[model samples]
Target: MAPLSKDPATLATQGKKAMDESKYDEALTLYTAAIDIRPNSPLFYLQRSICHQRLQKGQEAVDDAEIALYLAEKLGKRDLKAQAQLRRGIGYFFLHRLGDALQCLKWSKKLDEKEKSLNLWFPKVEVGLSKLEEGDERANATVPELPDVSDKIAAEKPSTPAPVSNASPAASTAVKQATGVTTPVDKIREEMIQNNTHVTWTLYVKGVPKDKASVIMEPRSFHISFPLANGSEYSIDKDPLFAEIDVDNSRSSVLSTKIELHMKKKVEGKKWLAMEAKEEDVKAEQASAPVNKPAAAPSYPTSSRTGPKNWDTIVTDVNDDEEEGDPVNSLFKTIFKNADDDTKRAMMKSYVESQGTALSTNWEEVGKKKMEVTPPEGMEAKPYEM
Candidate 1:
């Protein structure tokens, strides 16, 4: 097929059409072309930014959205300006720029009271802001006073005529001053963790006592099946593990106690997975093993409940650009990189076979149930661009 022309309006229209059809990559290319032709058009940049976001290019998306906001403001287009602000704010939220995000979102709300679209699209922004306030910085902030909804009848009560009493004017002034006073730690945290924000947790791995080491956190919990590198038949069938995390609020942050992992023993006889020997015994085995030193074993992560350090690491890990060649990624890449080796090939094999066996035995009965739930239009799976 011939390449599309780079005319601004033509590219813009094609980009919109591609976006509508969920051809996000094509839409991005078209939008970029449109911007190339008319670099000052905020609409083109903003549209391209949406595509960048869908592709999970967080930094690029934020940059494009920011440019859109600046251009929209320069153009004096209020609606477009509000949109740009909201987009940039959402991008910031994903980038963990809580303070900047809240400022932008608040301004966007002020520009347009109808925030339903923003709320729907960016529910996490609110969650993130709320969580941030709940943490160390804004934890002590006083909540805004809500009107007493207790008594409608009292509101309608007639005011009694009072005689002017010869009271000290200074005493009245003192009472008024006292009523208006703010508390020592009552200032709200400027940075907010939005309501729908995804909270990241870290699992610290360390040796017994003080010689602590590596920490890792995955989005969700799963059984760790570490395939040993050497021919050593060592295996951990079932072991208790934990993930430590920090709970943050608008004002302050606190560490959550460890999240425990309870695994059932893979072997029928053993209740707990065992090492062939105690920690001391392992030293002997290490000495006898081949002289080629195996890579250092990953230390169990510390419990985040210990302090804010875990939270800091979590934020740092998540926010750091993967392309920057961080040591943390390299460390993780080394460990469990051979998870799908021959030794662990049966990891899901038995499970699948067992399920298949049951399905085959009950196929007829299940088929009857399936007939009732079948869609009116037959379902077909197809790969589509987005």
Candidate 2:
């Protein structure tokens, strides 16, 4: 038959299948051909590195992993880079560079502590280092014997799900089909926190295996299922998300502490006020949301001993005097300009509220009580009786 199809996606899928069957050598050959056809794919390089790691070729593994990490960094793919660093650390372990291997593995954990593979190697590396520190010269620290199906134990992730979009990076995680109706049972505890561009649901399920869990990502909903430690299955199903999400960018991870499910917000900068939407979600959200408006200019600074003064009214009074050419008004304006902040405040409060019957400079007494019109001895102050 003619050589395997030239399509990189087909070759990648084939390589994954071979690795699943423990045919790592054949997987390596297929991935190499895939890399030749599309040399820029960090995903392909990373997969090839996995092949070398399984075949126990230390240098070749590191070589491919280095290329994968370099390309991953260029692509700004933290997830892919974490996997690359993890495999590179394994390569260093096979080469007997325990110190370098430990460093790479720790860095990989820092990149993504939830990568899962770090859990397996951390204890093994620590034990080996402890023996070396104790001066055990003959203690060659190698991983446990590789078994036919033990790849499940060491693999960074489960076999690639054959999602329809073979060329997309999301093909790495095919949306799993729900086995049955999945609902959160009383046995599990779940918490969700919404962020601006992303939302995360945290599940605290004890003794959850990485391979035992499954996730289904969709634009408006998601479902996740896993077998619990107590010989029962647990699941969380949200059919209607509070808002739409980018299904392609959504992902999940499991850790010893909790299981984290992340979904990217479909509308950038849109806040999901709640985890589930309702008929009145929009109205309630708008009512509770803070109004973000441009700030108003601050009032003119004043050392008024009483309280805030109507500086706008004072300015308008000055303008009126200029237009009318009132001698009394001009004289009062001169007095106002010469007064201190407190004196000016008392003049405005007493003059305005007293209806021009008084203009006081005593700020200390004016602030003690509200100003009231005190008509001359012969006059009586009356509201709306002017």
Candidate 3:
């Protein structure tokens, strides 16, 4: 496809066409471009708000809707404000904010009684509120699914070349051989590690000021950019991570010499075939993934008759006579099965890095310090000889 026209008006029109065709990602980019050029235009934000809603980005949808509402209010355009309120209410609904959603929808109705979308949203909010009152915490109505982008992904390939065939990672090293992903500059090197329950990517850079760096880790992608010593900026915005990650748990740490990103995998033990999921990969993922909408995970109820439940120990039954194929291995397996995600991560990291000389499950302590090989009292650690 040809590039979008530079004019803001043309971009907005193109965005509208794309939005109508359900090409939300394209529409979002176009609308963002238009908004950049025409900062004062409420219409652009309103259109972008719809795109965000269809993408199921509730916060972004709410933000854009508020921007449109604010601009409309200033101009006293009751009709635009009504539409904005309707979108705002839907955005709040997607965020599972029942009270806020109801208020916004009511305002939208007061502004324009004939608004068509209100008919669908009003009852959704009511149902959600009723469910909340009835002791159902996860009671929000179904929001729009994220835009299906397999076709778009297939069409737009990365500028940089990657291996046509996916390579298997080394279990011990967690990195694929001869598969280092380099950045725009030859000096920067990046590696992706598929750890036991998460993925960690490290970027080798130097002399980066803490305040000048910006790193964003999202569910499907990540973006990194920072100022270099030579007055130039280094950036790499990778879209579509090899697999989905848990955004809330995924985090980044910046050190003096390197930056590390720890991304909790959405599905445990799912190997990443590549650093980025190309066309074929996305299709396979969609095919194998669940067809139903998102469902909440079941929580273990506590017998805490008072304040918060204690995490120091959970009373779980384990049969003492259970078969032990490998006594040591069975013990580790038993401990791992009952451990949480963080504890599992800590155990893996410490055991692997310490050369099996130490094992620790305290995530807080393990995270802040580097692990070292502490051999048995009589044994000494040494480099492996070929």
Model 1: how far is 243 from its true place, Å?
56
Q: Judge candidate 1 against the unseen true structure and give its global Cα lDDT, from 0 to 1.
A: 0.42
lDDT of each: 0.42, 0.63, 0.64
Model 1 sits at a Cα RMSD from the real structure of: 29.5
Tell me how many residue pairs clash in candidate 1.
46
TM-score of each: 0.35, 0.37, 0.36
The residue ranges of model 1 lying beyond 4 angstroms of the native Cα positions read 121-123, 132-386
170-232, model 1: which lDDT tens digit per residue? 986664444321212122112111122222222222111111110111211121111111211
Model 3 poorest 10 in a row by lDDT:
296-305
Which residue ranges in model 2 land beyond 4 Å of their true spot? 133-386
Candidate 3 residues 272-309, lDDT tens each?
Answer: 87778886876666556443422332222221223332
Preferred candidate (lDDT higher): 1 or 2 = 2
Q: Which window of ten consecutive residues has the lowest lDDT sum in model 2?
A: 144-153
